[model samples]
Target: MSFIPRRPPRHLLRLLVLLAVAALLYFYSAPVFNAAARSLIRVDAPAPADVVIALGGDARCMRERRAAEIFNRGLARHVIVSGVPYAWGVHTGDAAKRYVESLGVPAERITVLRDAWNTRREAMDVNELMRAQGWNRAILVTSPFHSRRAHYTFRRYAAEYTFISMPLEPEPPEWQPERWWSRRGDLGITVREYLSWINTLAGGWR
Candidate 1:
Protein backbone atom coordinates (compact mmCIF):
# COMPACT_ATOMS: atom_id res chain seq x y z
CA MET A 1 0.00 0.00 0.00
CA SER A 2 1.30 3.43 -1.00
CA PHE A 3 1.09 6.15 1.66
CA ILE A 4 -0.20 9.49 0.33
CA PRO A 5 -0.22 12.94 2.04
CA ARG A 6 -3.82 14.08 2.22
CA ARG A 7 -4.80 17.66 1.35
CA PRO A 8 -6.39 19.83 4.03
CA PRO A 9 -10.15 19.37 4.29
CA ARG A 10 -12.41 21.87 2.49
CA HIS A 11 -13.97 23.04 5.77
CA LEU A 12 -10.55 23.67 7.27
CA LEU A 13 -9.51 25.57 4.16
CA ARG A 14 -12.62 27.77 4.43
CA LEU A 15 -11.92 28.49 8.09
CA LEU A 16 -8.33 29.42 7.31
CA VAL A 17 -9.47 31.75 4.55
CA LEU A 18 -11.90 33.54 6.87
CA LEU A 19 -9.23 33.95 9.52
CA ALA A 20 -6.83 35.37 6.96
CA VAL A 21 -9.44 37.80 5.73
CA ALA A 22 -10.21 38.97 9.25
CA ALA A 23 -6.56 39.49 9.98
CA LEU A 24 -6.08 41.41 6.77
CA LEU A 25 -9.07 43.56 7.54
CA TYR A 26 -7.90 44.33 11.04
CA PHE A 27 -4.35 45.14 9.99
CA TYR A 28 -4.87 46.79 6.62
CA SER A 29 -8.07 48.70 7.25
CA ALA A 30 -7.14 50.27 10.58
CA PRO A 31 -5.40 53.34 9.09
CA VAL A 32 -8.41 54.00 6.87
CA PHE A 33 -10.70 54.02 9.88
CA ASN A 34 -8.33 56.28 11.77
CA ALA A 35 -8.19 58.76 8.91
CA ALA A 36 -11.98 58.76 8.65
CA ALA A 37 -12.35 59.43 12.35
CA ARG A 38 -9.90 62.30 12.19
CA SER A 39 -11.65 63.80 9.19
CA LEU A 40 -14.73 64.50 11.29
CA ILE A 41 -12.64 67.00 13.24
CA ARG A 42 -11.58 70.42 11.95
CA VAL A 43 -9.50 73.05 13.69
CA ASP A 44 -9.13 76.32 11.86
CA ALA A 45 -8.38 79.60 13.56
CA PRO A 46 -9.29 82.06 10.92
CA ALA A 47 -8.81 85.81 10.96
CA PRO A 48 -10.52 87.73 13.76
CA ALA A 49 -14.28 87.39 13.79
CA ASP A 50 -16.85 89.58 15.42
CA VAL A 51 -17.28 87.06 18.24
CA VAL A 52 -16.12 83.72 19.63
CA ILE A 53 -18.78 81.16 20.58
CA ALA A 54 -17.93 78.37 22.96
CA LEU A 55 -20.55 75.67 22.52
CA GLY A 56 -20.81 74.29 26.03
CA GLY A 57 -21.03 70.60 27.05
CA ASP A 58 -17.40 70.10 27.88
CA ALA A 59 -17.07 69.32 31.56
CA ARG A 60 -13.31 69.81 31.18
CA CYS A 61 -13.71 73.46 30.22
CA MET A 62 -11.66 72.90 27.08
CA ARG A 63 -14.05 74.81 24.88
CA GLU A 64 -14.12 77.76 27.22
CA ARG A 65 -10.34 77.77 27.37
CA ARG A 66 -10.05 77.76 23.60
CA ALA A 67 -12.46 80.62 23.28
CA ALA A 68 -10.58 82.53 25.93
CA GLU A 69 -7.28 81.88 24.21
CA ILE A 70 -8.71 83.11 20.95
CA PHE A 71 -10.07 86.18 22.64
CA ASN A 72 -6.76 86.91 24.33
CA ARG A 73 -4.98 86.50 21.03
CA GLY A 74 -7.12 89.34 19.66
CA LEU A 75 -8.98 87.07 17.31
CA ALA A 76 -12.22 88.39 18.66
CA ARG A 77 -13.07 90.95 21.30
CA HIS A 78 -16.29 89.20 22.35
CA VAL A 79 -17.06 85.63 23.39
CA ILE A 80 -20.49 84.05 23.59
CA VAL A 81 -20.93 80.97 25.70
CA SER A 82 -23.88 78.99 24.34
CA GLY A 83 -25.72 76.10 26.00
CA VAL A 84 -28.76 75.29 28.12
CA PRO A 85 -28.68 74.80 31.86
CA TYR A 86 -28.97 71.03 32.07
CA ALA A 87 -26.57 70.42 34.92
CA TRP A 88 -24.97 72.15 37.93
CA GLY A 89 -28.23 74.06 38.47
CA VAL A 90 -26.79 76.98 36.45
CA HIS A 91 -27.12 77.90 32.86
CA THR A 92 -24.36 76.25 30.81
CA GLY A 93 -23.65 79.51 29.06
CA ASP A 94 -23.29 81.23 32.41
CA ALA A 95 -20.86 78.63 33.68
CA ALA A 96 -18.80 78.79 30.54
CA LYS A 97 -18.78 82.56 30.57
CA ARG A 98 -17.61 82.58 34.16
CA TYR A 99 -14.81 80.21 33.28
CA VAL A 100 -13.73 82.35 30.34
CA GLU A 101 -13.85 85.43 32.50
CA SER A 102 -11.66 83.71 35.05
CA LEU A 103 -9.16 83.14 32.26
CA GLY A 104 -8.82 86.94 31.85
CA VAL A 105 -11.48 87.57 29.26
CA PRO A 106 -13.32 90.72 30.32
CA ALA A 107 -16.88 90.14 31.59
CA GLU A 108 -18.17 92.89 29.34
CA ARG A 109 -16.74 91.05 26.36
CA ILE A 110 -18.49 87.85 27.40
CA THR A 111 -22.05 87.11 26.28
CA VAL A 112 -24.22 84.18 27.34
CA LEU A 113 -26.82 82.42 25.23
CA ARG A 114 -28.46 80.16 27.76
CA ASP A 115 -31.50 79.04 25.79
CA ALA A 116 -29.86 76.48 23.50
CA TRP A 117 -30.98 72.94 24.28
CA ASN A 118 -29.08 71.42 21.36
CA THR A 119 -26.89 72.35 18.44
CA ARG A 120 -29.84 73.55 16.38
CA ARG A 121 -31.13 75.63 19.25
CA GLU A 122 -27.66 77.03 19.77
CA ALA A 123 -27.53 77.93 16.09
CA MET A 124 -30.86 79.70 16.36
CA ASP A 125 -29.82 81.60 19.47
CA VAL A 126 -26.48 82.54 17.92
CA ASN A 127 -28.12 83.72 14.72
CA GLU A 128 -30.55 85.87 16.64
CA LEU A 129 -27.73 87.31 18.68
CA MET A 130 -25.70 88.05 15.57
CA ARG A 131 -28.58 89.85 13.91
CA ALA A 132 -29.37 91.79 17.07
CA GLN A 133 -25.76 92.80 17.55
CA GLY A 134 -25.05 93.39 13.87
CA TRP A 135 -22.25 90.86 14.03
CA ASN A 136 -21.02 89.44 10.73
CA ARG A 137 -18.88 86.45 11.71
CA ALA A 138 -18.24 84.04 14.57
CA ILE A 139 -15.79 81.36 15.63
CA LEU A 140 -17.58 78.19 16.82
CA VAL A 141 -15.69 76.17 19.39
CA THR A 142 -16.50 72.63 20.57
CA SER A 143 -14.86 69.33 21.45
CA PRO A 144 -13.04 67.67 18.59
CA PHE A 145 -15.37 64.71 18.29
CA HIS A 146 -18.38 67.03 18.12
CA SER A 147 -16.87 69.55 15.70
CA ARG A 148 -18.30 68.11 12.50
CA ARG A 149 -21.90 67.87 13.58
CA ALA A 150 -21.77 71.20 15.35
CA HIS A 151 -20.30 72.87 12.27
CA TYR A 152 -22.92 71.31 10.02
CA THR A 153 -25.84 72.30 12.21
CA PHE A 154 -24.59 75.83 12.73
CA ARG A 155 -23.93 76.36 9.04
CA ARG A 156 -27.36 75.03 8.19
CA TYR A 157 -29.11 77.42 10.54
CA ALA A 158 -26.79 80.43 10.54
CA ALA A 159 -26.31 81.01 6.85
CA GLU A 160 -25.95 84.75 6.88
CA TYR A 161 -22.67 85.15 8.77
CA THR A 162 -19.43 83.23 8.45
CA PHE A 163 -19.09 80.46 11.05
CA ILE A 164 -15.65 79.01 11.60
CA SER A 165 -15.64 75.57 13.27
CA MET A 166 -12.79 75.19 15.74
CA PRO A 167 -12.09 71.83 17.32
CA LEU A 168 -10.33 71.71 20.66
CA GLU A 169 -7.11 69.80 21.31
CA PRO A 170 -7.78 66.08 20.93
CA GLU A 171 -7.41 64.53 24.37
CA PRO A 172 -7.23 60.82 24.89
CA PRO A 173 -10.16 58.66 26.07
CA GLU A 174 -12.56 61.06 24.36
CA TRP A 175 -10.86 62.02 21.10
CA GLN A 176 -8.58 59.09 20.37
CA PRO A 177 -10.01 57.68 17.18
CA GLU A 178 -6.93 55.73 16.22
CA ARG A 179 -7.30 53.62 19.34
CA TRP A 180 -11.08 53.78 19.31
CA TRP A 181 -11.70 50.11 18.56
CA SER A 182 -9.35 49.06 21.34
CA ARG A 183 -11.41 50.67 24.09
CA ARG A 184 -15.13 50.60 24.69
CA GLY A 185 -15.31 54.25 25.77
CA ASP A 186 -13.47 55.61 22.75
CA LEU A 187 -15.44 53.33 20.45
CA GLY A 188 -18.72 54.52 21.91
CA ILE A 189 -17.72 58.17 21.41
CA THR A 190 -16.64 57.60 17.85
CA VAL A 191 -19.83 55.71 17.02
CA ARG A 192 -22.05 58.25 18.69
CA GLU A 193 -20.38 61.12 16.87
CA TYR A 194 -20.74 59.34 13.56
CA LEU A 195 -24.42 58.76 14.19
CA SER A 196 -24.96 62.39 15.12
CA TRP A 197 -23.03 63.46 12.02
CA ILE A 198 -25.30 61.32 9.88
CA ASN A 199 -28.35 62.77 11.60
CA THR A 200 -27.12 66.26 10.90
CA LEU A 201 -26.57 65.42 7.25
CA ALA A 202 -30.10 64.01 7.04
CA GLY A 203 -31.66 67.19 8.45
CA GLY A 204 -33.05 65.31 11.42
CA TRP A 205 -31.69 67.53 14.18
CA ARG A 206 -34.76 69.35 15.59
Candidate 2:
Protein backbone atom coordinates (compact mmCIF):
# COMPACT_ATOMS: atom_id res chain seq x y z
CA MET A 1 0.00 0.00 0.00
CA SER A 2 1.28 3.47 -0.76
CA PHE A 3 2.18 5.31 2.38
CA ILE A 4 -0.18 8.28 2.25
CA PRO A 5 1.41 10.81 4.52
CA ARG A 6 -1.15 11.95 7.08
CA ARG A 7 -2.11 15.62 7.17
CA PRO A 8 -0.56 17.67 10.00
CA PRO A 9 -2.68 18.30 13.09
CA ARG A 10 -3.15 21.99 12.31
CA HIS A 11 -3.91 21.25 8.67
CA LEU A 12 -6.47 18.61 9.66
CA LEU A 13 -8.13 21.15 11.94
CA ARG A 14 -8.25 23.67 9.14
CA LEU A 15 -9.71 21.05 6.77
CA LEU A 16 -12.48 20.27 9.25
CA VAL A 17 -13.16 23.94 9.71
CA LEU A 18 -13.47 24.43 5.97
CA LEU A 19 -15.90 21.51 5.72
CA ALA A 20 -18.06 23.08 8.40
CA VAL A 21 -17.99 26.43 6.66
CA ALA A 22 -18.92 24.82 3.36
CA ALA A 23 -21.87 23.20 5.06
CA LEU A 24 -22.89 26.49 6.59
CA LEU A 25 -22.65 28.22 3.24
CA TYR A 26 -24.83 25.57 1.60
CA PHE A 27 -27.54 25.89 4.23
CA TYR A 28 -27.13 29.62 4.67
CA SER A 29 -27.73 30.22 0.99
CA ALA A 30 -31.24 28.78 1.28
CA PRO A 31 -32.28 31.80 3.29
CA VAL A 32 -30.91 33.94 0.50
CA PHE A 33 -32.88 31.91 -1.99
CA ASN A 34 -35.92 32.52 0.15
CA ALA A 35 -35.14 36.19 0.49
CA ALA A 36 -34.61 36.70 -3.24
CA ALA A 37 -37.56 34.57 -4.33
CA ARG A 38 -39.82 35.95 -1.65
CA SER A 39 -38.91 39.47 -2.53
CA LEU A 40 -39.36 38.77 -6.23
CA ILE A 41 -42.78 37.05 -6.19
CA ARG A 42 -45.74 39.20 -5.18
CA VAL A 43 -49.47 39.84 -5.54
CA ASP A 44 -50.55 43.48 -5.53
CA ALA A 45 -52.11 46.41 -7.34
CA PRO A 46 -50.25 47.98 -10.23
CA ALA A 47 -48.80 51.47 -10.06
CA PRO A 48 -49.35 53.99 -12.84
CA ALA A 49 -47.22 53.51 -15.96
CA ASP A 50 -48.13 54.26 -19.54
CA VAL A 51 -47.34 50.64 -20.33
CA VAL A 52 -47.13 47.82 -17.79
CA ILE A 53 -44.10 45.49 -18.22
CA ALA A 54 -43.86 42.04 -16.65
CA LEU A 55 -40.48 40.35 -16.52
CA GLY A 56 -39.96 36.61 -16.96
CA GLY A 57 -40.13 34.00 -14.16
CA ASP A 58 -42.22 34.03 -10.95
CA ALA A 59 -42.69 37.73 -11.52
CA ARG A 60 -45.25 36.60 -14.10
CA CYS A 61 -47.75 36.07 -11.32
CA MET A 62 -47.17 39.61 -10.14
CA ARG A 63 -47.50 40.87 -13.69
CA GLU A 64 -50.82 39.14 -14.27
CA ARG A 65 -52.29 40.32 -11.00
CA ARG A 66 -51.03 43.88 -11.41
CA ALA A 67 -52.14 44.00 -15.02
CA ALA A 68 -55.75 43.52 -14.01
CA GLU A 69 -55.46 46.00 -11.18
CA ILE A 70 -53.98 48.67 -13.44
CA PHE A 71 -56.56 48.07 -16.09
CA ASN A 72 -59.29 48.52 -13.55
CA ARG A 73 -57.58 51.62 -12.16
CA GLY A 74 -57.35 53.01 -15.71
CA LEU A 75 -53.68 53.79 -15.06
CA ALA A 76 -52.51 52.72 -18.51
CA ARG A 77 -54.38 51.96 -21.68
CA HIS A 78 -51.90 49.23 -22.69
CA VAL A 79 -50.32 46.26 -20.89
CA ILE A 80 -47.22 44.59 -22.38
CA VAL A 81 -46.36 41.03 -21.38
CA SER A 82 -42.70 40.14 -21.98
CA GLY A 83 -40.90 36.76 -22.16
CA VAL A 84 -40.89 33.80 -24.49
CA PRO A 85 -42.61 30.46 -24.04
CA TYR A 86 -41.20 27.04 -23.43
CA ALA A 87 -42.50 23.80 -24.98
CA TRP A 88 -44.09 23.06 -21.61
CA GLY A 89 -47.40 24.65 -22.69
CA VAL A 90 -48.55 28.02 -21.21
CA HIS A 91 -46.49 30.93 -22.51
CA THR A 92 -46.11 34.05 -20.39
CA GLY A 93 -48.33 36.13 -22.65
CA ASP A 94 -51.18 33.65 -22.56
CA ALA A 95 -50.82 33.19 -18.84
CA ALA A 96 -50.76 36.95 -18.36
CA LYS A 97 -53.88 37.45 -20.44
CA ARG A 98 -55.75 34.75 -18.58
CA TYR A 99 -54.75 36.32 -15.29
CA VAL A 100 -55.85 39.81 -16.33
CA GLU A 101 -59.06 38.41 -17.76
CA SER A 102 -59.82 36.97 -14.36
CA LEU A 103 -59.64 40.56 -13.14
CA GLY A 104 -61.84 41.75 -16.06
CA VAL A 105 -59.27 43.49 -18.29
CA PRO A 106 -60.61 43.48 -21.81
CA ALA A 107 -58.66 41.38 -24.29
CA GLU A 108 -57.98 44.43 -26.43
CA ARG A 109 -56.12 46.16 -23.63
CA ILE A 110 -53.54 43.38 -23.09
CA THR A 111 -50.63 42.91 -25.53
CA VAL A 112 -48.49 39.85 -25.14
CA LEU A 113 -44.95 39.50 -26.61
CA ARG A 114 -43.76 35.94 -26.72
CA ASP A 115 -40.78 37.05 -28.80
CA ALA A 116 -39.00 38.88 -26.02
CA TRP A 117 -36.00 36.60 -25.54
CA ASN A 118 -34.59 38.24 -22.41
CA THR A 119 -34.65 41.39 -20.26
CA ARG A 120 -32.78 43.29 -22.93
CA ARG A 121 -35.09 41.95 -25.59
CA GLU A 122 -38.17 43.02 -23.64
CA ALA A 123 -36.87 46.54 -23.21
CA MET A 124 -36.02 46.79 -26.89
CA ASP A 125 -39.33 45.28 -27.93
CA VAL A 126 -41.29 47.65 -25.74
CA ASN A 127 -39.33 50.64 -27.00
CA GLU A 128 -40.02 49.60 -30.57
CA LEU A 129 -43.69 49.25 -29.70
CA MET A 130 -43.69 52.72 -28.20
CA ARG A 131 -42.38 54.24 -31.39
CA ALA A 132 -44.75 52.41 -33.71
CA GLN A 133 -47.80 52.70 -31.43
CA GLY A 134 -47.23 56.13 -29.92
CA TRP A 135 -46.71 54.94 -26.31
CA ASN A 136 -44.69 57.72 -24.67
CA ARG A 137 -44.40 56.31 -21.15
CA ALA A 138 -44.68 52.94 -19.42
CA ILE A 139 -44.96 51.23 -16.06
CA LEU A 140 -42.54 48.32 -15.60
CA VAL A 141 -43.96 45.52 -13.42
CA THR A 142 -41.60 43.15 -11.68
CA SER A 143 -40.87 41.77 -8.21
CA PRO A 144 -39.32 44.03 -5.62
CA PHE A 145 -35.98 42.25 -5.50
CA HIS A 146 -35.67 42.37 -9.27
CA SER A 147 -36.77 45.97 -9.63
CA ARG A 148 -33.26 47.39 -9.62
CA ARG A 149 -31.73 44.98 -12.09
CA ALA A 150 -34.75 45.12 -14.33
CA HIS A 151 -34.73 48.89 -14.27
CA TYR A 152 -31.04 49.12 -15.10
CA THR A 153 -31.34 46.58 -17.90
CA PHE A 154 -34.38 48.29 -19.37
CA ARG A 155 -32.98 51.76 -19.00
CA ARG A 156 -29.92 50.71 -20.93
CA TYR A 157 -31.98 49.14 -23.66
CA ALA A 158 -34.67 51.78 -23.95
CA ALA A 159 -33.04 55.08 -23.20
CA GLU A 160 -35.79 57.13 -24.73
CA TYR A 161 -38.66 55.49 -22.87
CA THR A 162 -39.69 56.89 -19.51
CA PHE A 163 -39.55 54.07 -16.98
CA ILE A 164 -41.59 53.69 -13.79
CA SER A 165 -41.38 50.74 -11.43
CA MET A 166 -44.52 48.92 -10.37
CA PRO A 167 -42.82 46.38 -8.17
CA LEU A 168 -44.98 43.86 -6.29
CA GLU A 169 -43.74 43.55 -2.73
CA PRO A 170 -44.70 39.98 -1.84
CA GLU A 171 -42.87 39.88 1.48
CA PRO A 172 -41.50 43.36 1.75
CA PRO A 173 -39.07 43.24 4.62
CA GLU A 174 -39.13 45.87 7.31
CA TRP A 175 -35.34 45.83 6.96
CA GLN A 176 -32.94 44.23 4.49
CA PRO A 177 -30.42 41.63 5.59
CA GLU A 178 -27.94 43.14 8.02
CA ARG A 179 -25.16 40.59 7.46
CA TRP A 180 -25.87 40.46 3.76
CA TRP A 181 -22.16 40.52 2.95
CA SER A 182 -21.61 37.24 4.80
CA ARG A 183 -24.49 35.73 2.87
CA ARG A 184 -22.77 33.96 -0.02
CA GLY A 185 -25.87 33.35 -2.10
CA ASP A 186 -26.92 36.96 -1.77
CA LEU A 187 -23.40 37.76 -2.88
CA GLY A 188 -23.82 35.34 -5.75
CA ILE A 189 -26.66 37.43 -7.12
CA THR A 190 -24.85 40.65 -6.52
CA VAL A 191 -21.73 39.23 -8.10
CA ARG A 192 -23.61 38.16 -11.16
CA GLU A 193 -25.17 41.60 -11.34
CA TYR A 194 -21.81 43.27 -10.84
CA LEU A 195 -20.28 41.19 -13.58
CA SER A 196 -23.10 42.22 -15.84
CA TRP A 197 -22.56 45.82 -14.88
CA ILE A 198 -18.89 45.46 -15.61
CA ASN A 199 -19.61 43.95 -18.99
CA THR A 200 -21.92 46.86 -19.65
CA LEU A 201 -19.27 49.30 -18.61
CA ALA A 202 -16.87 47.67 -21.03
CA GLY A 203 -19.23 47.69 -23.99
CA GLY A 204 -22.83 48.04 -22.79
CA TRP A 205 -23.82 45.33 -25.23
CA ARG A 206 -27.34 44.06 -25.27
Candidate 3:
Protein backbone atom coordinates (compact mmCIF):
# COMPACT_ATOMS: atom_id res chain seq x y z
CA MET A 1 0.00 0.00 0.00
CA SER A 2 1.28 3.50 -0.92
CA PHE A 3 1.31 6.17 1.84
CA ILE A 4 -0.03 9.67 1.09
CA PRO A 5 2.05 12.73 2.12
CA ARG A 6 0.28 15.61 3.92
CA ARG A 7 1.01 19.32 3.31
CA PRO A 8 2.25 21.51 6.15
CA PRO A 9 -0.43 23.24 8.28
CA ARG A 10 -1.53 26.71 7.10
CA HIS A 11 -0.51 28.38 10.38
CA LEU A 12 2.98 26.87 10.25
CA LEU A 13 3.43 27.97 6.62
CA ARG A 14 2.33 31.51 7.55
CA LEU A 15 4.71 31.56 10.53
CA LEU A 16 7.62 30.48 8.33
CA VAL A 17 6.86 33.21 5.80
CA LEU A 18 6.69 35.80 8.56
CA LEU A 19 10.04 34.73 9.97
CA ALA A 20 11.63 34.93 6.54
CA VAL A 21 10.28 38.42 6.00
CA ALA A 22 11.51 39.55 9.41
CA ALA A 23 14.98 38.22 8.74
CA LEU A 24 15.11 39.97 5.39
CA LEU A 25 14.09 43.27 6.94
CA TYR A 26 16.58 42.88 9.75
CA PHE A 27 19.42 42.40 7.31
CA TYR A 28 18.43 44.94 4.60
CA SER A 29 16.98 47.82 6.59
CA ALA A 30 20.16 49.84 7.13
CA PRO A 31 20.03 51.74 3.87
CA VAL A 32 16.37 52.63 4.32
CA PHE A 33 16.99 53.74 7.89
CA ASN A 34 20.02 55.74 6.85
CA ALA A 35 17.96 57.62 4.31
CA ALA A 36 15.37 58.36 6.97
CA ALA A 37 18.09 59.62 9.30
CA ARG A 38 19.54 61.81 6.59
CA SER A 39 16.18 63.42 5.98
CA LEU A 40 16.81 65.57 9.07
CA ILE A 41 19.55 67.51 7.32
CA ARG A 42 18.74 70.84 5.66
CA VAL A 43 21.24 72.80 3.60
CA ASP A 44 20.36 76.03 1.91
CA ALA A 45 21.92 77.26 -1.29
CA PRO A 46 24.75 79.73 -0.83
CA ALA A 47 23.55 83.30 -0.81
CA PRO A 48 24.69 86.70 0.30
CA ALA A 49 24.12 87.43 3.97
CA ASP A 50 25.07 90.08 6.49
CA VAL A 51 26.84 87.55 8.65
CA VAL A 52 27.71 83.89 8.98
CA ILE A 53 27.37 82.29 12.40
CA ALA A 54 29.32 79.12 13.16
CA LEU A 55 27.86 77.20 16.10
CA GLY A 56 30.61 75.40 17.92
CA GLY A 57 30.78 71.82 19.24
CA ASP A 58 32.98 70.21 16.63
CA ALA A 59 36.52 69.43 17.73
CA ARG A 60 37.21 68.99 14.00
CA CYS A 61 36.27 72.63 13.37
CA MET A 62 34.04 71.71 10.42
CA ARG A 63 31.60 74.54 11.18
CA GLU A 64 34.32 77.16 11.27
CA ARG A 65 35.75 75.79 8.06
CA ARG A 66 32.40 76.17 6.34
CA ALA A 67 32.01 79.70 7.67
CA ALA A 68 35.39 80.63 6.29
CA GLU A 69 34.44 79.24 2.89
CA ILE A 70 31.26 81.32 2.88
CA PHE A 71 33.19 84.41 3.91
CA ASN A 72 35.86 83.83 1.28
CA ARG A 73 33.18 83.47 -1.36
CA GLY A 74 31.98 86.99 -0.44
CA LEU A 75 28.61 85.59 0.55
CA ALA A 76 28.76 87.05 4.05
CA ARG A 77 30.24 90.30 5.28
CA HIS A 78 31.15 88.99 8.72
CA VAL A 79 31.60 85.77 10.69
CA ILE A 80 30.43 85.08 14.22
CA VAL A 81 31.76 82.20 16.27
CA SER A 82 29.48 81.15 19.11
CA GLY A 83 30.59 78.60 21.65
CA VAL A 84 31.12 77.84 25.30
CA PRO A 85 34.42 77.08 26.93
CA TYR A 86 35.86 73.70 26.14
CA ALA A 87 36.67 71.14 28.79
CA TRP A 88 40.30 72.25 28.71
CA GLY A 89 39.35 75.91 29.38
CA VAL A 90 39.83 77.31 25.89
CA HIS A 91 36.71 78.97 24.59
CA THR A 92 35.60 77.32 21.34
CA GLY A 93 34.46 80.69 20.06
CA ASP A 94 37.95 82.07 20.39
CA ALA A 95 39.40 79.01 18.77
CA ALA A 96 36.93 79.23 15.90
CA LYS A 97 37.78 82.88 15.40
CA ARG A 98 41.45 82.07 15.12
CA TYR A 99 40.76 79.20 12.76
CA VAL A 100 38.58 81.26 10.47
CA GLU A 101 40.99 84.18 10.52
CA SER A 102 43.75 81.80 9.54
CA LEU A 103 41.63 80.77 6.58
CA GLY A 104 41.80 84.43 5.30
CA VAL A 105 38.80 85.96 7.03
CA PRO A 106 40.00 89.23 8.55
CA ALA A 107 40.23 89.20 12.34
CA GLU A 108 38.41 92.54 12.41
CA ARG A 109 35.42 90.96 10.70
CA ILE A 110 35.01 88.09 13.16
CA THR A 111 33.13 88.35 16.43
CA VAL A 112 33.37 85.72 19.12
CA LEU A 113 30.54 84.99 21.57
CA ARG A 114 31.80 82.59 24.20
CA ASP A 115 29.02 82.58 26.76
CA ALA A 116 26.30 80.57 25.03
CA TRP A 117 26.20 77.05 26.41
CA ASN A 118 23.61 75.72 23.97
CA THR A 119 21.86 76.47 20.69
CA ARG A 120 19.01 78.46 22.23
CA ARG A 121 21.40 80.69 24.13
CA GLU A 122 23.51 81.04 21.03
CA ALA A 123 20.47 82.17 19.07
CA MET A 124 19.55 84.73 21.73
CA ASP A 125 23.08 86.09 21.92
CA VAL A 126 23.48 86.15 18.16
CA ASN A 127 20.17 87.92 17.80
CA GLU A 128 21.42 90.63 20.12
CA LEU A 129 24.61 90.90 18.10
CA MET A 130 22.70 91.10 14.84
CA ARG A 131 20.46 93.78 16.27
CA ALA A 132 23.43 95.84 17.37
CA GLN A 133 25.16 95.41 14.03
CA GLY A 134 22.01 96.23 12.10
CA TRP A 135 22.34 92.91 10.30
CA ASN A 136 19.13 91.58 8.84
CA ARG A 137 20.29 88.41 7.12
CA ALA A 138 22.45 85.65 8.56
CA ILE A 139 23.79 82.25 7.55
CA LEU A 140 24.10 79.43 10.06
CA VAL A 141 26.89 76.87 9.64
CA THR A 142 26.86 73.65 11.62
CA SER A 143 27.28 69.90 11.35
CA PRO A 144 24.98 68.29 8.80
CA PHE A 145 23.12 66.35 11.47
CA HIS A 146 22.53 69.56 13.40
CA SER A 147 21.36 71.88 10.60
CA ARG A 148 17.62 71.22 10.86
CA ARG A 149 17.25 71.77 14.57
CA ALA A 150 19.72 74.63 14.55
CA HIS A 151 17.80 76.42 11.85
CA TYR A 152 14.51 75.80 13.63
CA THR A 153 15.79 77.06 16.95
CA PHE A 154 17.28 80.19 15.43
CA ARG A 155 14.10 80.94 13.53
CA ARG A 156 12.05 80.45 16.69
CA TYR A 157 14.24 82.78 18.73
CA ALA A 158 15.30 85.33 16.12
CA ALA A 159 12.38 85.70 13.81
CA GLU A 160 13.35 89.23 12.88
CA TYR A 161 16.38 88.18 10.89
CA THR A 162 16.55 85.91 7.86
CA PHE A 163 18.46 82.76 8.76
CA ILE A 164 19.84 80.37 6.14
CA SER A 165 21.19 76.97 7.05
CA MET A 166 24.35 75.69 5.37
CA PRO A 167 25.26 72.41 6.94
CA LEU A 168 28.67 70.91 6.22
CA GLU A 169 28.21 68.84 3.08
CA PRO A 170 30.39 65.97 1.96
CA GLU A 171 30.75 65.48 5.70
CA PRO A 172 34.12 64.52 7.01
CA PRO A 173 35.17 60.90 6.80
CA GLU A 174 34.74 60.41 10.51
CA TRP A 175 31.14 61.56 10.47
CA GLN A 176 29.71 60.28 7.21
CA PRO A 177 25.92 60.09 7.41
CA GLU A 178 25.84 57.01 5.18
CA ARG A 179 26.38 53.83 7.15
CA TRP A 180 26.41 55.92 10.32
CA TRP A 181 25.24 53.01 12.38
CA SER A 182 28.44 51.12 11.65
CA ARG A 183 30.51 53.57 13.68
CA ARG A 184 29.91 54.20 17.34
CA GLY A 185 30.66 57.92 17.20
CA ASP A 186 28.49 58.52 14.16
CA LEU A 187 25.68 56.47 15.72
CA GLY A 188 25.83 58.54 18.90
CA ILE A 189 25.76 61.78 16.94
CA THR A 190 22.82 60.64 14.87
CA VAL A 191 20.83 59.45 17.87
CA ARG A 192 21.52 62.59 19.89
CA GLU A 193 20.53 64.86 17.02
CA TYR A 194 17.21 63.03 16.59
CA LEU A 195 16.49 63.28 20.31
CA SER A 196 17.40 66.93 20.36
CA TRP A 197 15.17 67.55 17.37
CA ILE A 198 12.28 65.89 19.18
CA ASN A 199 12.99 68.00 22.21
CA THR A 200 12.98 71.13 20.08
CA LEU A 201 9.68 70.12 18.57
CA ALA A 202 8.30 69.64 22.09
CA GLY A 203 9.29 73.21 23.04
CA GLY A 204 12.14 72.02 25.18
CA TRP A 205 14.68 74.38 23.76
CA ARG A 206 16.24 75.78 26.88
**Best model per TM-score:** 3
Given candidate 3, what's the lDDT at residue 101? Answer: 90
Q: Which window of 10 residues has the lowest lDDT sum in candidate 1?
A: 171-180
The candidate, 1 or 3, that scores higher on TM-score is 3
Off by over 4 Å in 3: 1-17, 20-24, 87-89
Q: Report the alpha-carbon TM-score of model 2 versus the true structure.
A: 0.64
Cα lDDT of model 1 overall?
0.83
Q: Which model is ahead, 2 or 3, in terms of lDDT?
A: 3
TM-score of each: 0.85, 0.64, 0.86
- Stretches of candidate 2 exceeding 4 Å from the true structure: 1-48, 170-196, 199-206
Best-performing candidate as measured by lDDT? 3
The runs of at least 3 residues in candidate 1 whose Cα sits more than 4 Å from the true structure, single-residue gaps closed, are 1-20, 87-89
**Candidate 3 lDDT over residue span 78-184, tens digit each:** 99987777778678778878899999999999999988788888999988898999999999998888888899999998989999998888455535678888889
lDDT of 1 by residue, 7-105 (tens): 999999999999999999989788988898888887776788999988867777788898999899999979988667676676767778888899999
**Candidates 2 and 3 compared by TM-score, better number:** 3
| Candidate models: Cα lDDT each | 0.83, 0.66, 0.87
As for candidate 2, its clashing pairs are 51-138
